[model samples]
Target: MQATLMIYNGTAAPDADVLRTGGVPLAPARTTWPMCGNTCGGPMQFFAHLPVDYGVLSVFVCQNDPGACDTHDPVSGANRVLLFPSAELVPVAVPEEGVTLLPAVSAITTAVVTLEPEEADEDGLPPDAYDLARGGWKWEPGELFGKQREVLGSLGGSPSCLGDDRLPECPSCSGVMEFAAHLEEGIDRRSAMNLGGDLGYVFVCRPCSQGAFLRD
Candidate 1:
């Protein structure tokens, strides 16, 4: 499988037009900051600003009460993925309370890589596209182990080890959402968007102008 890997490019300005994690989100006027309404009624942490083919994906997750908020469920109200128009967006107002933004803003760049499936198991199942791509990322030549921390995530790939039943449905159109991106925790622990040591998945319903977020 071929995937576009998101490589960490060090700290960046908060409002740049490249892929980045942790910064004030840019959204249309009147777009209110989302809250974690599932368990903790605090503001959701701004996660990333990802520019996809369709639009910019503005992500948020609950950090006020991570484990208790059910951030891993798409419809749990603990995490959110908003598809915003790339143009005419302004920085969103930051909430005064709770964990609203990551500690730092990290820039990202892309690299195209080809991933080959590992030998099939006894059941003859192929290796997951995401797993294969993530495990094979090599930042430098001859490096035995890829620097997982430097890998922010990938774009345009299927979910890693996610079951078919877990696919998110679009709240606006009630149709199955299309896979958008795979997000990793990030390069620095203190500034990273927490995902409970699992990979984060982003799904979108383009026609409905909606998106969903979950982790696995």
Candidate 2:
């Protein structure tokens, strides 16, 4: 939610310290996720289309970007929001001889995502793997419906593995997960179109043999 802004004056190797995976890896090579929106977390890469430039030439913070908020629900399979920077002045590379620099813009700030939760995740990808499969769906003898009802009842019809957040995790265990498979179109609320064919990653915890899914 909160982030540190960086108005780089020159070219720098995308903060190698940051991450570069997940999502559709846009083009122009300018959008490189350097870090989280708050602290040292995951890298959220996306050129925010904020109405104004906040003088944030670059940024390093939590993966949560304020200007580029695209609420995408992998489970609901909806759309992703597109947030941008709030900078007023646009900076460009003017190579004079062999050097270049960025013109000062505005000021940038960071804070917890006070913005109301968007309808969907920003990447347009499912928040988690199970998101592809609604909560409490069960398997049964020619009647997966009953089993599903039971599962839903067990989950208290929560329709979510992770609290109210919609972020999914391995209830059976805890740890990072590995992408198992993807169920794009055919799957009902299985995954977002952005990640349907390229759904979330599945993980089988080493400890409990439990599984978790990350839609990213």
Top TM-score model: 1
TM-score each candidate: 0.93, 0.18
Off by over 4 Å in 1: 116-119, 139-144
Give me the candidate number with maximum lDDT.
1
lDDT of 2: 0.26
Off by over 4 Å in 2: 1-24, 41-142, 145-216
Total clashing pairs for each candidate: 0, 44
Cα deviation of 177 in candidate 2 (Å)? 31
Reference-based lDDT, residue 45, model 2: 31
Candidate 1 lDDT, tens digit per residue, 116-145?
646777887766766666676764678877
RMSD of each: 1.9, 18.8
Model 1 lDDT at residue 210: 93
Instruction: For model 1, give the 10-residue run with minimal summed lDDT.
Output: 130-139
